[model samples]
Target: MDKAEKDQQDDSQDKMVLESVSGRRLSYDMKTPFYGDCRDVDDFKKLNRVGEGTYGVVYRVNDTKTGRICALKRIRMEGETDGLPLSSLREIMILKRMRNRNIVNVTDVAVGPQLESIFLVMEYCEQDMGTLMDAVPTPYTPSEVKCLMLQLLEGLNYCHKNYIIHRDLKLSNLLLTREGILKIGKLKFPDAQHQTHGIDLIVLFAADFGLARTLSFPSKPMTPKVVTLWYRAPELLYGDAHYTTAVDMWSVGCIFGELMKHKPLLPGNTEQKEIELIVNLIGSPSDAIWPGYSKLPFAKTLNIPKQEYVRVYMQSKPESFFHHTENAPLLSSFNNLKLEFPRATEHTLSLLSGLLTYNPKARLNVKQALRHPYFIESPRPLDPSLLPTYPEIRNQVSEKEKNRRAHDEERKKRLAHEGNDSIFSADHYKKRRKD
Candidate 1:
């Protein structure tokens, strides 16, 4: 079933008694055939392929029953695997618990009848932010940029609240609906939605929870799940495994800077060079202000002693900030973009600064981060009803509506229960051997 169906069921189940009221009795019949693993899902015809990801291919499918439009993420089997992959299971688990405008929602998941593929049904999104950013030629106004930042912060705030951290927060992960509503499109957010934001009419959304992780109450250091090189945060460069939600906050800061500059602030190819580029743009780490700098795994190898470096990189040449809009105030480098985007005003910047601070301890927690002026004082407020939207979203909702979370869970457990026999497992050697 799809997400909407599951929600309706969940709503009804909320009122139902937890005690068991029904049980299935196994009976042998001469004519009745027992369909178990041999009988897979026999629903929903395959439609056009939409996109591909690290694990599978996405298709724009039509639900035969409701004639609904939905995006189906098909999980490929690695041959003879009876169950689903852990990534697929986790994605289902996370999507089930997550309900927000900025996060992508899963509506349905079904196994192919032949056990050939698994399908993930989600709200059909038109485009991704990265594609839109490249496709849309009109530059963003300061107000528009603020609108986007507020939505992203709000979404991030939600994840932090739930102890979840989206490690892969990049442009490609944001998506957009056809009508321009940022439906947590691509990484997540619409291309052009006139969302009510105080005096403005624009909103942004954060998408892609594939790389997200949850922390415990006290929070513990996590694995170095670094995003792409361009969006990698500073602490990750130092090999800090015991990081907190601050790591995601740093990602937010990086994305905020990009929204303003229309370019990646610190685009590095290697860990060493990445730090070198960051230190060049924001200046290298200093023990004086960043006391624990020298102790970092990478910091101990700094060639420069005393760390007397400029805020901007020593090699970076000062350049005038381009005005994307006419009659707009001049933007000083990215360091001061918060000034240009009111949503990123002083308090917001301060909060973001803490996230990007050389010292992780100085970073803001989820609660503290949301309290930042960017979110608290922003003119635009997050409204959930303004979600799953796009020009086509409403039309697609009727047919696409199913409880994807529950369906995903069933498929996930089925996949897990099957283990190595699961087709979702990756095999780099497949093509080589086939050739």
Candidate 2:
């Protein structure tokens, strides 16, 4: 072919390709489907932030499309180089599968303009159990406590039936709707992991499964670093890799005690200290108590002696010998569950004993706990409609806000002190010169 004909044909092909590219870009721009589902994150107006944590920031938002108030949780993607976080993915996946009255619902999910942000649209609950307990001046009656507990058990039962174990069950995670329905919230993905000094009563839903695991026969060994220190089970403290739902029951027992006393049952500063506190309150475990007690990963490595040694003189031998006690000195140790919660009934104590049983095998599962006489006898679980109503407690500032205010206050105080020091120095210099 001639050079001129070849050049003309090439130009025509290039022009057509450019036109096709332009058409595709325009189509994409016009389509603009919602970032994830119904709308972008910007579609929801953030009214105020409700809570914040390592995984996400929760905001009270208004959906402009539906004009409905909702809780929008923005999953933190900051500094994430490996793409979307596994925590966010697990939460979204789990919430999609779980559908129950007691469980919190993830209504929608949306992303920001740059796809850097992921917001989970959830059903808004007026307050969480922690906030309600803190704000409400009136304490919940035993019947009311039963009602809440039943709801929690119901939710937990559902989870267990589905093979999901909520590893981080706490008051803050149990959200309360205006209608007195308890919906679990803050379903986080598993990892290694409150203050209610005068708080009275609260929830029926288990929340915060960040460290939660699915049940498996001969469950795969997982990190023992789960559950908050206060609500943590002894098996976890002992570094037991293999565990089941019993760990959750132990947490429930702690919560049960808290409801009765309005204070934490076993508050500890460190893992060792926490173990010490548990030993002090429940008596140290022996082979009989915790069958495989010595086999725990941390048991042999513990800084403290496995058994308490007492020095005693042997009259028969006429020599000094040490009497080794297998378990913590029972005389010095006491189970103060009853002492601390004197008002709790015998049935209540029995139930608590089952839930808090040192042996994981003996510990009551959610089903057994729900059927316990403590719940069935005397005052039955109150009707949901009859649950006491309290004024919604809304914190004026988020955690970040509180910290910022504190920083400002400290800065002002430092500036004031520095100013005083400068004036004092000036006055002293003048006096010395005059002299």
Cα lDDT of model 1 by residue, 41-156, tens digit:
24456666667765466777777766877776655544434344323333443454467776667664455434444555677766666665654556555455556666666667
Write down the TM-score of every candidate: 0.61, 0.71
**Candidate 1 displacement at residue 346 in angstroms:** 5.2
Please give the distance, in angstroms, between residue 1's alpha carbon in candidate 2 and its true position after superposition: 46
In candidate 1 the C-alpha lDDT for residue 123 amounts to 77
Q: Candidate 2 at 177: error in angstroms?
A: 1.4
Candidate 2 lDDT over residue span 1-435, tens digit each: 899997887675444323322222122223211122224677789898888877677889999978999988876555555444333443454565568888787776566544345567888888888777766657678998888888888888887887776777777778888788887667653222211111120011112434555666657666688788988998998899898888888888887776666667778888988887766556667667668988888887765424431222212311111133122112212255556667877667666766766778767788767766677778888988788766556745658988997986676566556665665454454465479
Per-residue error for 37 in candidate 2, Å, reads 3.5
On lDDT, the candidate that comes out on top is: 2
RMSD of each: 15.5, 14.6
Query: Lowest-scoring 10 consecutive residues by lDDT in candidate 2?
Result: 195-204
- Model 1 spans > 4 angstroms off: 1-42, 76-82, 85-91, 114-116, 179-208, 217-221, 302-355, 365-370, 374-435
